[model samples]
Target chain A: MGSHAERKRRDGAQPSARVPSASPAAAHAHRESMPDGAAPAVPGLIRLQPSSVRAAAQTPLHLLPCEIQHNGPAAVSRFFSPAIRPGSSGPVVSFRGRSLHGEEVTLPSGYMGLVLREDKSEGPEDRTVQAIGTFSCFTLWGLEAPPGPNARMHRALSWPSLATAIHAPVAEEDD
Target chain B: MLSHKKRPAEVHCDQWVLVAPESVTDLPGKTENGPVFTRLHNPRTGEAALYLFDTNAQQLFEVKAFHEEFHSWFIGQTVQHDGRLLLVTPVDPLFMVLYYLIKAEKEQGKFQPLDQVVIDAEFPSCSMLLQCAKLRPFLHHVTEEKEIGNKKFYKYSKEKTLKWLNKKVGQTVRALKIGNVNVGARVSSATFVPGDHGSDVKEEDYICYAHGLISEYIPKELSADLAKYLKLPELSASLPEPPLKKRKVSDGPVEAEEDYTKFNRVDLKTKKTNSKMTAAQKALARVDKSGMRSISTFFGTKAKAGK
Candidate 1:
């Protein structure tokens, strides 16, 4: 049974290699190589559906939220984190304390974290972590694990508690 | 818990960048590269610092490190950014009025709203006014005329308005050049130059002409010689009415008994003595009586003995 499973895995890998080689450019060249033939004429008797006409019209691209993947720290240093490897399927994991629509989240102890979002909104990006006091780094969901040595030690904190600590009004001293 | 004094070198330039509007993302997820930030040059301090705005974060950051490290000279002058001029000074009523006036002009399509109010209101000295005048001719050439009043009364366009303002300033400078008004003096002199024809004259010549005209207009108290050159009327005719006659009082020897307290003592005593008598008795007593609302009116009748 184990040998059969291994054989199946090897076959699957071979098909994947051939699939990438069938490029659009190669197909186009193959079509050009064929002998010229008279194309079949369309019949005027058939009426085109309005849905087909509508489909031909250009529609503005509607940006939609897709999968979010956690990339390693090397990717994070390059400003790409939890790398959403292209074609992955799952909603992206959002940062805590940051607004969903993109706005600034002031961190405690004068620390400020900026969450960059796909949606362009005036003002700050949503979700923010003002200041994670005494923590080097925090955990994000769906990440395999904290990235290597460089990933600072961070404490996972609730959004509200972090906000309360950061935005707490300063008390005045009696002179 | 690391605390360090933020020095100029320690200032994080990366945090100071100004965010461009379009690079924002729609999802709640984080982006690796945010919008670009630009550092502004502080002319006074000769320092540069970064600026940024994050829409997703809805926060403006002026990175403390930058503020601590750099010397900023943005004290009095206004700063321009993102299609708006940031006024550094506190908004006073006078500034508010001027701001609205400029806003009105902008709404009328005459001037760009974002243009800085270049006129330095602090200490508008004469030298500055003169400098403004030096730029007048160029201003006048660039001024465009616009119809303002009924029957097409021509007025200066924004360019023309600025130009005329510059020329008026130059005229002031020329007027100051002549020995009419001293620098720092509270007083100002007005000059008028006649339109000259058939003469090749430089701009300096116009200044000289203006100076001479202003000198001529100076009040006679300041320059009698200037008054003579202008041939102004010397004096006005006097009125012909005679002075009024004086009145005289007699110095008499009839020697009527002089009782200085006659009215107060005798009259009041007589009135008190006759209080029991009827109204007929008071009417019969011969006291020079007159009804007056106040004591001042009664005493006002008597003049000083010498006068």
Candidate 2:
């Protein structure tokens, strides 16, 4: 029975590769059977809606509550705990603050687990952090950021607090 | 002094001045002598000018009436006619009165209500009397209505009446060259030519009155002009700051008398002298008057023992 289940699992992985290469005619026929074109319900594989994805992408950093700290011997100066990487296009999984010249510093992880890259897409000069990403998580250490400023971190998948977000019911859309 | 060399032939009254009304001419002759060349004295310039007038001209009908009513008599010449004293002149004195009225109107560039008396008094000499007389008939007194106790009073329009009077009098005025320009004098076309008598117009010297200029170093010519320009003569006497306006010291220090009635202390003193009271009543009265005693004093051991 274990050997048969393993074979079924391998078969499922093969069909996923075929799903991308499927012809439009095949998708049309398959869509007619489902009618709604909804993906088959799967655990932990919930497809993010395009509207939700857009909302996540456009979320501003100032909206997030962050830990502020005054480090150094006297604690006279203050700075954000997750060192703000100013002038970045979006949330970058950088380990250090951005220099005055806008180049990311090569310092060791001075930031907390979370990294908030300053959203310079609006006001390029502003230092306020707008979007967020995990700099180094247990599962995401050494993970490279995707190319381009448009790459957005999915909050439901990235944040532990939002673990139940995938289980939340999606309102069925007819069109 | 009268000029006798190549004297210009004297023109008749009709040619030189506005003719008198026919009413004046129709009057019966009262003076034996027709007219005479009378000398009129001008108090302002001391010009003893002569004018030809007859016995009729010396009569006070025109002069006395104008003088007693509104205009001044200072402009009239004193003349003796037929054993009677008269203030008269051949050139109508009213001409000068009108010229001044017109002049005052032009100065402020607005029509002003004027009294005929004020015009005559202000300009007493009539050098341009003949010129003004010729223009006088054209002038008319504008009646202005002023409410006084429900009655409307008529006043002459000083500027408007004079302008209207001189409208036909011809703008050109011819008079003797008297160095000083009169009210009605017009500029002749003749340009001033500097003759051998030095420069008729002296050139003003240039002087720098800027900072660091020394008074002693200033040029003599410029210093004179600067002094004249600034009218320094009036400020020549330094008045030592008027001695700082010393306060007037009189007999003694004056103290204002205090009035006890203002504080009602007089009535309180009278009440104290007139009324008698027991010790308790006196204490109560003291408390009422001064409010300085404590209520604890009234409830003391001695007062309770007495009760």
Candidate 3:
């Protein structure tokens, strides 16, 4: 993962990779060194690669109870994927000796989960994130027992209908 | 517990994994004609927001990214550091146009051609709003129009606009009912199930809730007018604490009173997000909080206490 990401950056094939937290000072310095010499601003809209954005294969995911500090490749398939077993109540797994309770959660209908990739290349125009992938479900892991109604992810998922209610179009003319 | 056949090298690039309307993948025939992403004035707050205009600029979509702390995404073979889930939903383009129309009302304070009223040097692309197909059909909802010598002119009409907005609240109220959204339940945590306890919530609560959602799309002043038009009651003082103070952008030590996705309006590369964060949030933004427990930890304690 890192090698390809690095190769893309080196090859100037920067996609719309979102750099979340480059402090003002660091971004300011980087801006000075940047060849185009402009602020490395995240564009307002991520250009979608129309050619590649078809139905993608279902991607497996795990919502861990604890956060992992690192942000790169891991042997999820080799060490972790094989361990997800169908427990009596739900799926069960263990990582680092702690039992993880899991439940499969699907996004509410009409919504699709996406994995969008971008890069650090410069001289930008229509920067893209076509390493694009999609999913509709993931296994949410909790400690001891899987999260129920109280999980934040569940609450967050409930936001869409409200958003629909909020942004849903009104009549062009009132009777 | 962990094994690596070949650990991948350090990836410097960041990834954005989000949940968007399935229709986002729908592209027009021309590649150059895919959804046009641009910044538009958020009518409610007068702030710039990232918006996408569908091909032909007929429909508007707001990219909403819900955020929580210390979260990241593990894509197929890679890990994305940012954890917020983005959503793109159709938004009424007229709400965006209203920002400019209201501004023109305040500045020129007179009826003007739509083209002249919609101009904004700050967001040069805002002119694209003039091209939206719905602009003509829906312009009458918020404005009074007059035809003179085959040319049509318009002026922002507060009365008409408020009535239109009231209808918006009414429809939203009906939708909340249809969706069984528990409007009375304060979403204080993820464990909050709408119907679980907020069931006895009043009809006023539904109207108020819908009003709040609609308020996010119009100016605060107009939102107040809509509230008056709807005759919605003031937030009763019966709650546990004082109402959250609404602060101006320059005010000091303002709490982040609402959604974390306010970052959607900001340039992601820069850290000075328009976030009016509290000390804890400010600290949270700077810290590297890997290995930290998620909100589920709190759930454990809550369950233990309940048992």
Flag regions of model 3 displaced more than 4 Å.
Answer: A1-45, A119-122, A172-175, B1-13, B28-32, B185-191, B197-199, B235-259, B262-307
- Model 3, A1-175: lDDT tens digits are 1232242243233111222332222211221111222322533344555665564566876666543434666677877778889887798987656687888889988887767655334334434556367789977777667777666677567666666766666765536
Off by over 4 Å in 2: A1-175, B1-30, B33-49, B52-94, B102-166, B169-307
Q: In candidate 3 chain A, what residue range of length 10 has the lowest lDDT sum? A: A25-34
Q: CA lDDT, every prediction?
A: 0.21, 0.21, 0.56
| Each prediction's TM-score versus the true structure | 0.15, 0.16, 0.74
In the range A34-82, model 2's lDDT, one tens digit per residue, is 1112322220011111221122221111211111111112111133224
| B-chain TM-scores per prediction | 0.16, 0.21, 0.74
Which DockQ-derived CAPRI band holds candidate 1? incorrect
lDDT of model number 1: 0.21
Q: Write down the DockQ of candidate 1.
A: 0.00
How far off is residue B219 in model 3, in Å? 1.0
Predictions in order: chain A TM-score: 0.16, 0.16, 0.69
Superposed Cα deviation of residue B279, candidate 1 (Å): 99
* Cα misplacement distance, residue B184 of candidate 1 (Å): 43
lDDT tens digits, residues B107-177, model 1? Answer: 55343221122232221111122132122223223223233443221122444333332343354444334
Ranking by DockQ: 3, 1, 2
Per-prediction fnat: 0.00, 0.00, 0.35
The DockQ of each candidate is 0.00, 0.00, 0.21
lDDT (C-alpha) at residue A38 in model 3: 38
